[model samples]
Target chain A: MTAAYYAAVDWGTTSFRLWIIAEDGTVLAERRSGEGMTTAAKTGFPAVLEAHLAAVAAPAHLPVIICGMAGAKQGWVEAGYLDTPAALSTIAAGAVAVPDVDRDIRILPGLAQRDLQHPDVMRGEETQLLGAAGNLGDGRHLVCMPGTHSKWVRLEGGKVTGFSTFMTGELFDVISKHSILSHSVADAQVFSGEHPAFLAAVAAACANPALATNLMFGVRAGQLLHGATATDAKATLSGTLIGLEIAGALAAAGAVDSVCLVASGSLGALYRAALASLDLSPRIVDADEAVRAGLSTAAQAIWPL
Target chain B: MTAAYYAAVDWGTTSFRLWIIAEDGTVLAERRSGEGMTTAAKTGFPAVLEAHLAAVAAPAHLPVIICGMAGAKQGWVEAGYLDTPAALSTIAAGAVAVPDVDRDIRILPGLAQRDLQHPDVMRGEETQLLGAAGNLGDGRHLVCMPGTHSKWVRLEGGKVTGFSTFMTGELFDVISKHSILSHSVADAQVFSGEHPAFLAAVAAACANPALATNLMFGVRAGQLLHGATATDAKATLSGTLIGLEIAGALAAAGAVDSVCLVASGSLGALYRAALASLDLSPRIVDADEAVRAGLSTAAQAIWPL
Candidate 1:
């Protein structure tokens, strides 16, 4: 069997994943845990990484390439950002090395849109973009990466012209748990993309994004006046947020020929359905694979086998 | 002072106000407390009302006219709703008397827009509308009542055409408290409508209401990348929500001659400033006075002396 070449880690705010890859680019071992940057920050980033590395039985000298919050200012090491307009290939050049470590460890820098008006910053998603860029090829593509903070990137050729982050997932969470709509969706049964309420909300919000909050309120009113089920309320809330996101993204990236959605699991499915509902079939890219591929690309660039 | 003739009360979701009126229709004594429907629901609504009434030194036989959440199905009595296109004068006639109560207490009905597409209900704000209608007269007036759940009413010839509720204030609260933006506005100083950040955000949101959530995210991004102040973050958040609400309200109302702002205190000042930023000078009305006037209007109609 080929020896492990390097370890790739996606250290997020609340999740940690590690992959031991062979020189042949095959994943030899894998590990995942909830001890992400948040936990690692408290329990020492090195210790947490070492524990995960040990769990994967990675070679002692196996170099590691890390992305996401581990590179944030509040993460393991402060890996600064690359200001846009930036080339996806240049991300490897901005990777920051951890000081005084036995094994070589590098954390990829984030992207910063320093436009005084917009002034957006992204940590982990840049890596995903780097990986997804291959699938997107050299064209003007609107890439939607759905997550806690859903990012919509405008990529021209291999360069990221601009991007916008919608607080979709986070807003959904806070709204459901903290807002008055909480009562409307309490103990809601699991719903899917095909939900009537969800589809209708997506259509309504995409049509009139101005009425996003009003539509959110309708979740409660619908339950009260229309006897809308808990699931209906939940679906409506989800669709409203997702729909507003799509509208804003479309508005920002005017007349895009293709949309690349880099997402995983249920979230990806949801976004795909929403996009389809809006008469757009986005090019699907598995986010998990994209991040791993991105980390591998960075690792190969830094330590070519 | 003349003996107390009737007690006018505005019982809301989180607040309660009582005004003892004399035979001359003058406020002889007044009481205000946080014993709103929420508190009353847990601690007996009748007891809470009696405590406030007794504090105001109202006569036992004095009739009481109440409005707002006290008339909700979950409140002291189910006063029900007056469906649209409802005449402002019809609100008093639909008042539901508190069954088996010592006093002749009647809680005024709220307004319900039962359109299946946009089902909406308002309690206390309906009373405010009832009073504000007298001042507005026969016209196409867009009434913007800014609060936790801001109600934008469309009145055509003293009859309610329709209305929309923007969850502006509640969203601000939940987003500021529970979302990542919480860090951006942790110790924010009190800011008003004149704030440059506030004005800019208001302008941005109004112009591009579709980008409401994105604008909301900018509060955090601005802080992280542009070193935006806490006050700036807070003001920006305030402006974004209010501006989006205004945009939605205007879009829903369509071609109104004038905008009527019925609000109180700093919130009123804030809305006025937000409206002015968009070149809209809304005719202002005190929310407190409007509710009182609405209750008085209902009182006179229910039990004409």
Candidate 2:
């Protein structure tokens, strides 16, 4: 029998990625293209799918599961939102059925937080959460997904009870890239946490959260007065923002007791150290692995034996 | 005898503006061009000066005064800062004498706050303060200069002792241009202070300063949930930011008691009403007039008859 192939799509704002999977949930062929929601505006949805499929010679009909910006309001088709506290099993279990596909195509609904004093929302992270629960297996877990908008989510028995977002990455991008601090930072400065300069910035931000406004100028002061390198200054700025986010998140989520970070790449490792500074044990997991695992969970639901 | 023509140069990051003045400081001709610090990267001091002369026909032997980004470290020339409690007259009196100019050419030194726990800096706004002092003739005036980085300076007897910089304009630009709030706001919104909508937003920001962060999302929430028009939502966001800036500046400077604002233009007038909500009086003035008056103060100091 021909191996049943499944498709997983992580459609984001600036890029759309696709992974073709075999029956055993291994990625058969992966493809990435520039057809994100923003760029696919004039051409619209049909063009996005057609551009990605142009590379692969596959059967016309196949089961496909997708997540992320494709589910946003202005996306190809809005998948709406799954109100929290949402169960990982429930999230994996629920899918927005697509219209007019020769084969079954389901779009995942993102998690939404309302009815709280302050409402918050998330779209793609739900898939990551479901995948985390599947990988770690049905128990209480804390996941810190850091990006432009970092999400701190709590899962108990594979259900997402609550989550909060910190604009740390976006804030850093804005302040360091656009604000007065930009003058202090050089174009190319990427430092690791082991650096003494990085440690100094984390310590300062940790000591006084409000000092962020003033501490930003320290980059310039360091450069002008002490002749500190631009690379060190950039690292310091990043460390300061991450440290502040971690402190604020810990207080808000009460995650200091039991927190595990689900991040990827250098940003993930940086966050791991940031959490460690505040005496929190963090289990850093590969984000891509979780994305694949999530696709498997959805595939299993759709192709149950 | 022909009227002794004075020259005012407002050199900034991305643009250069100059006003040729008659003996009484009346503008004869004003010229604007994109020879700001950012554009004149390859060509240093001489290029910036030459760029100005190219845009505006000024006698090589004319008394000329300059300010703004040209004094920055990266500018054509770095004219050092004048420490506070600094009077405009003091900086005018101590104008940096640029060599090689046959006529009197003095670069005004920007003001800096010293007595405060942390120091603050101002370049172009010092000119605005001087203009306010020269025009209003001093006596406890509160001046608000709105721009990318807005400054609130408290002047008593033509002396700018202390001031605070609020990233109000920058924050608005960031949130509207980059943040999630951008979706809810329209391209432009008309200001009508008497409208219940406007007053409600001002009150919300004033009632709880910490709510400033929360208020930002209200623009989106108001549009999405409350059936608010995009224009109204945008206006509310703008009002809230400006209102927060006013409240924070007032509290920080301890100028709540008997404070009178010197604002410029209709946008300035709208802010005046926002200030009035807090039981403070604000007078609207012309922005161009303030710059001219400021230039005149600097000119008189360098070329005292």
Best by DockQ: 1
Provide the DockQ value for model 1: 0.85
Candidate 2 C-alpha lDDT tens digits along B81-178: 88778767776775677777566667777776653233467777787677766556646766777666667777778777677666666666776776
* lDDT of all predictions: 0.91, 0.69
List each candidate's DockQ score: 0.85, 0.13
> How many residue pairs clash in each candidate at the backbone level?
0, 2
Worst 10 residues of 2 chain B by lDDT: B255-264
Error of 1 at B95 (Å): 0.6
Error of 1 at A252 (Å): 0.8
Q: Please state the i-RMS of candidate 2.
A: 4.9
Of the native A-B interface contacts, what share survives in model 1?
A: 0.75
Predicted complex 1: CAPRI docking category: high
> What's the TM-score of each model vs. the native?
0.99, 0.76
True-structure lDDT of candidate 1: 0.91
Error of model 2, residue A36, in angstroms:
3.7
In the range B201-270, model 1's lDDT, one tens digit per residue, is 9999989988988888888888888899999999999999999999899999999888899999999999
Task: State the RMSD for candidate 2.
Answer: 5.4
